[model samples]
Target chain A: MNTKQTNEMQIEFDSKSENEGFARVAVAAFLTQLNPTVEEVADVKTAVSEAVTNSIIHGYEKKRGKIFIRCIMQEDEIVVSISDKGKGIADIKKAMEPLFTTKPELERSGMGFAFMEAFMDQVDVISEVGIGTTVTMKKKIENSSTFRVSGDELNG
Target chain B: TGEVKRFLRDDGMIKVSRSLKEIANKVRITKDSLNGTLNREPTLEEIAQELNMEREDIVMALEAVGEVESLQKTIYQ
Candidate 1:
């Protein structure tokens, strides 16, 4: 028997030379249940691209490394964790500060965390300087079909 | 999408420890104007038509962010 309580998926990829669009498309396809608006979908895809890019370009520092991405879907929420086994950030606080990228030459805006914080309901980062970094993010779904807010409004 | 992560690139409020007015000023002035000029591929007329704001206003906004970060909220909604 399969015990599939909440649908979950995991992907492992090289931290060097990974395709951004591939990750975006895969995540979008897996999230088909949301029936999300195009804007919402775009938002999520962009966010994923940013996170993965950071892992590949910054976390791994152009060296070979492993990136782990996990997606879990609950009734009204989706959670994602992107982790990397590489030289972790020395300072999580400063790293998260807006426009504080270690690699400015790569055209990084340092707004990755800011964008994540604004779009998602919650975001947390855990890192150890010599070990790795983990980014856990969550978003609440706005599905009216599950519950009605008022009689005047329709789910459609 | 399921695995999306929002990008946050701005370096906001460096003077948070100093004063709220300083924070407001940064919000008001520190945008990299060059971004608005070179990074923005749109023409002045296009921005004017899309934003419903005067061309100069659009220029001002772009000048702040180095480029237009967003066209207009109306475009999305």
Candidate 2:
């Protein structure tokens, strides 16, 4: 579907750790038209990778499932949502807590949600025990022209 | 996800380049360490010296890994 407000793309693939890199690179590639800085692109990729990994490792628990990733570009911002139909987080708030992981034996590090929040301007996680989980993230890209003008003004 | 692309290394080995986040983790450092330094953001040379890596490697590895882990890893089990 197409909307006047934003350009959107949705992709669904098997839930696997190997696909994590793909998800991030695809999103970063789609964002190339915006000419984001390497840092900005890396930030988005890291966030995307974390969310996707959570869906694969935690949501499906290494089982076979489908991961849905949707990307929307609006004006000077990019919104990406990763969703999965698998065992959902029971306590989202606790899950978001840094270093709080249910699977410590797996060396999870339990910092997925924290990374998502730090990289994106906004992160919203919605989940239900048996239903599913969706992580929506939005990032505002600073326009180069505006940035240059502001820098010039400051110097002048 | 999309199509997969694979490339071989020059030494006939399959080399997988690590992400910046992974690189940062290997050094046991965070972006804040670099940001916390004096007047302005330090150059790649400065960061390389701090990390004990080559300037080129640091430049190539330079990226925003974001703050992944805020707390030290403790034995929870």
Among the numbered candidates, top DockQ falls to 2
Q: Chain B TM-score, candidate 1? A: 0.30
Misplaced by over 4 Å in model 2 are: A1-5, A144-156, B1-77
- Model 2, residue pairs in steric clash: none
**Fnat per candidate:** 0.00, 0.00
iRMSD per model? 15.7, 9.8
Q: Give the TM-score of candidate 2.
A: 0.62
Regions of candidate 1 where Cα sits further than 4 Å from its true position:
A1-5, A144-156, B1-77
Position A149, candidate 2: lDDT: 19
Per-residue CA lDDT of candidate 2, range A1-156, in tens? 754345679999999888886787778766644445445666788789889999998999999999999998876788999999999999999999989998887664877787788778999999999989999999987631111112232211
Top candidate when judged by TM-score against the true structure: 2
Q: Model 1, clash count?
A: 15
Query: What is candidate 1's lDDT per residue for A1-156, written digit by digit as tens?
Result: 954346789988777654665665566555544434333444566567778888888788878888888998776577888888878889989988988988777664688887777667788999998888899888765631222233232211
Going through the candidates in order, their DockQ values are 0.02, 0.06
